[model samples]
Target: MTATSISPKSSPDRLSLSELEAYIRTIDTSEYTKTRNYIGGSTQLSEYISRGMISLPRIRELVLEKNSFSASFKFLNELAWREYWQLTWTAIGDDIFDYIRPIKDTVRPAMPEAVINAHTGIVALDAGIRQLQTTGFIDNHMRMWLAGLVCQVAKCDWKVGAAWMHSYLIDGDYASNHLSWQWVAGSYTGKPYLPQQDNINTYTESLQKDTYLDQGYGEIASMEIPEILLETVDVLPAHEATLPEDTVTLDGLNELKNADTILLYSPWTLDPLWRKQDKAIRVLLIDPDVFSNGRFSQQVIDSIVWFAGQVADLKIICEPVKNLEVLTAAIIRKSYPGITTWPGIVDEPEMLFPEVPVAFYPSFSSYWKQIKKYSMTDQQSLF
Candidate 1:
């Protein structure tokens, strides 16, 4: 199986706050509700949200300033979905990688060769995979369709497919990517999410027929794994090993040795104004071990470095937190599991639904029920 062509132009570049605000203002909330299911329909803001380049509260505030909350509920709901995934991850911790519930059936150990090569012969699915690899972007509908194809139709393990997608997604949030795959795989939900050809045709505006998924939902539900999907492919994209040369010198860190506090930033917390008011040393920690396990692409790494460049006096350290010589009292935005650093101050990130407690809700509907009462409240006013 041959890999699809990678497009360098598709990589997400650094955007200034003004640029981000400009994009936010252009978002038409009315169009979002009517066309969100279509492949081309989306706010295209996930990349900004996933990298913590923008926060959920900021987006909600900006969206509400231009559109009424009632009119923009669909767009706000999508953002809340992102928050729900994160809250679920924080509740479950490392267990997010594991199946949330017992798997009803077993599947292949790895991703299907056809999916990796983007030659699944199913027109829309192949195009979505190609877009994901080449551009690191895909609409929410296509994401579900592709995940369902892998976990349900191809019968591959969700982790295998989820990891492959995460490696390429520009907005790859572990909480969102991993949990949504579990949802589609029937680990987080009752039934596997299967996408039929007609549904694909309706959303993608394609007319191709007689593919493996061309059958009715009942027929496709019980069919054996197709021959095309049976062949396993364990290939992951290769990333370059280049590190940023223009970085803050370690010499400057010596000045902060006696300082009372230091502000730490992770790849997920690249906010330039994180602690602008505080008088503290700023450090952006890039633990090599995290990347070794997460397997982010070179483009992702470069984009992160670009983000770090935006923050004033931010020193980018590649080693583990334990390797640092002086462990000053540090303040850090809470990150995902595997970050075991003992920071003196852990700042709670702004959540779309902060009123909802960080407890396990068996399903998203149940979780939403708890937050629905406050959904119409002005989010910025709550801060």
Candidate 2:
């Protein structure tokens, strides 16, 4: 998305420490349940949640305050999907970057040029790409459709398309971003997700027709890529997703050398109030080596810095985790291209199911059923 489109509804909203709690109080899940599947429907809060400005526990608490578990299940189910992906990442380790399941029907294996240019002839897909590039935001349904178009319809490799989309998303969490694309590409599920023409028009209201997408659900598996969509840019794996070198001038971190404890935060773990009571030095460790797995736009970088700023007395540094270890006995950070690995702490990143079983979850519904037994996680009691 572009600078002009960076609104709260589209991109992640920055809230000062005081404004955020108030923001949480006003969240309503009613409309999310009613129309979240539409292209314009549930854009309200995923970006915020994705960036860790808000937590699912807090959201679930708010939803439960007004409705029962069953009444709020749909919205909570959506939240669970995010947790499911993260848990899958934890369970599978670096496997999320690889195709979990392979398909025999893919005709092409690179990202389309039209998606990068935002000129796909399909009205809904083109608009979504524009919104993603311009606003760092697009609804989830659109994301799935775009992924389906690239991987299923256009026959591009999901790895290529996923890396391409991850670069532009403001809410670019690797587990969520890559895994969701895997889901659409039939690599992470039993069948590839192909959107029918009516499905696109019904939710997107584009009402356009006579393209390759204008087919019944049953015929979509064999549909040819449209001529306009046939032109594509070769991705590194999808084509080549270049991870930028970790090169930000580090804020002075030498000053904190004598501190008793270090509460390290990678981009994956930035929150203002985390461990606030623990007397420790908070450092926003910008380990390019770890976070360099996907390409990000300036807007994504800006959102991250904005989020990091919310933490009080946070030290910003640009270095590999190993370098920091040499700087002091301070904790080290080491992340590879797409997988985030922090050697300093054994603590897991936030997830509804923080510990994933060693076995792979064949589907989210199964993961949800097993985790739901205790993952409902009555977060209000913690208050």
Taking all chains together, each candidate's TM-score versus the true structure is 0.88, 0.84
User: Candidate 2's residue-wise lDDT over 1-383, tens digit each?
Assistant: 00010112222455664566566555466766778888778745765666666676766766577665665667777877877776777677788898887777744767788878877778888888889888788888898999988887778888888887887787887888898888888878767788777898999877899877888877877756777788887753222233322333223334455566677766666666677787776666666654455556766777676776666776666567665555354553322223244556544444545444635687987885666554555643212
Model 2 Cα displacement at 141 (Å)?
A: 0.3
Shift in Å, residue 245, candidate 2: 14
Candidate 2 stretches greater than 4 Å from native: 1-13, 235-253, 290-294, 329-340, 348-359, 372-383
Structure candidate 1, residue pairs in collision: none
RMSD values, in order shown: 5.6, 5.7
Best by TM-score: 1
TM-score, cand. 2: 0.84
- Model 1, C-alpha of 267: deviation from truth (Å): 0.5
